[model samples]
Target: MDMRAPEQKYDPYRNYTRQQWSKLRDDMPMALNADEIAALRSMHDRLDLREVEEIYLPLSRLLSMYVGAHQRLYIAQRKFLHIEDRKMPYIIGVAGSVAVGKSTTARVLQALLARWSPKPKVDLVTTDGFLFPNAVLERNGIMQKKGFPESYDLPLLLQFLSDIKAGRTNVRAPVYSHLTYDIVPDRFVEIDQPDILIVEGVNVLQAGRLPRDGKAVPVVSDFFDFSVYIDADEPVLREWYVKRFLALRDTAFHDPRSYFNRYALLSDEEATATALAIWERTNLANLEDNILPTRPRATLILKKGADHVIENVALRRL
Candidate 1:
């Protein structure tokens, strides 16, 4: 088989094996230590110093270059217009399946980007915050579809993005609690202007609905200067989801306030069975019907193996 992740005559991506992609790091030094990388990783995800140097280091360098270019463009635009307009944040969208470690990737990137020269302030935001409250979902009869695109408030999300791109300050977004598994009422996070903003979630790359009249309707990805998608086979993702769920039963689910606290009382076998049922009924359906379809929209793809390590990368041809 070819070393490429996928083979297609008309493919828009240039694929690279792990070894091949690691070479792209060139002489760049590692920016993170083992402890920092550990803290940045998701609860059930695997990330170490070597993973950072081999995978994320090169990625961070490439993103810094992109950010620098965007900065330069702003200066040129100012010169051309003979006016100093406010600098716009370079938004990056990170999208993938629920258990694919998009949160880990986002946090790691934010940390590394903030360390770049000129010292940019990077803000990391997840679309989980845009998810409708449980009350709203239940009222709308779509509570089971929580991670589906419909469970999100697209207008509010889009408006928040619009405000950030327009250099607005103190722009507030809703807050979500994974433990409670719902949106927190009257809670919000203010996003001031930042050099780069990473928007990560399972649905960030999804497009908004279009009207038949052909009027301009801005989708979530329309605001992204760059986008990344984490990819893995369905079996791998299912296994990861099940593993994470079982681990959570021993950890997060033990919290009395956790929405999944009931799972903590189940036997290991029972927990596993309950997890598989949820995966099949909710997560799997969302992945197939919503998330996976947006994969091609990403600017870069990180393809992971069964071990949760990035096996290869596919950079969309510019």
Candidate 2:
């Protein structure tokens, strides 16, 4: 296979303006019912189903086409290389800064892809499952850098993807707990081969830090058929982070097992200050050093406005 960069021009900050994307809103296909949409909308401080339709529907369709292309490539490779009886899963990687809406993008894409009658069993997985337990991070004195690429079990993650790409079935991924902010020991989700597999996280597009000699395989993104990077201005993302933290303090953080339980008792002023502090010291630092550098590595870039809506879509022209 000739491995070269796609011929498409890369535009880092292009997006669909609200008005343009809104035109597709009314007729968008929805995998979730109204009640589920409403519930997810309530969970997000400033997002709703309409946004999903306008911004994400087109994205879903785009991914579906890529998925089809990937399958065709697999068939061609098997015929030409004489490697019969091999079926690699079509993998998509979604990367972005923290609180930049990559999670919502992954989930929405998962649901939309499943709505395709031809491939209605799409599976969604996140790199969160590869993150080491909180206790391990604390012991390694990197708890504050939890979202950094080194925070994950890279070897294990790579092996998992390797299995899937090798046409292995019944693979399992660790389960992560948002409330606890850690990997749940002994818990895992089994993934069956599907037409598509979506993996979303802060650093999915990053190259591996270790050499391939006994310590590391290739980066997980190398296995992806398509990749996306969700982007927004640094300041806007910081504000969103703080806002999300405040909102979570009122909800998820209040739960007894939440790793952020300490935030539940913070006064509004204190909570805001803490959120800003964490963003500055940790999240923002990781975004600049790790995540931002990987944006150009994506096949598509979804840029956002201050209002937290995608404003333009930049597709790498093939």
> Tens digit of lDDT per residue, candidate 1, span 1-318?
566555444688989999988888887777778888889999889898888888988898788778889889889999999997689999999999989999999999999888887788899999999998899999999998999989999999999999999999999989999999988889999999998999999988888677999999888999999999999999999999999999999999999999999889999899989989999999999999999999999999999999889999999988
- Off-target runs (Cα >4 Å) in candidate 2 are 1-33, 39-42, 209-217
Best by lDDT: 1
Name model 1 segments beyond 4 Å from true: 1-8
Candidate 1's TM-score: 0.96
Q: Weakest 10 consecutive residues, lDDT, candidate 2?
A: 37-46
Query: How do the residues 89-193 of candidate 2 rate in per-residue lDDT, one tens digit apiece?
Result: 788899999988887777767777777876556788999999989889999999989989889999899989988887788899999999888899899999887
Model 2, CA-based lDDT: 0.82
RMSD of each: 3.0, 4.8
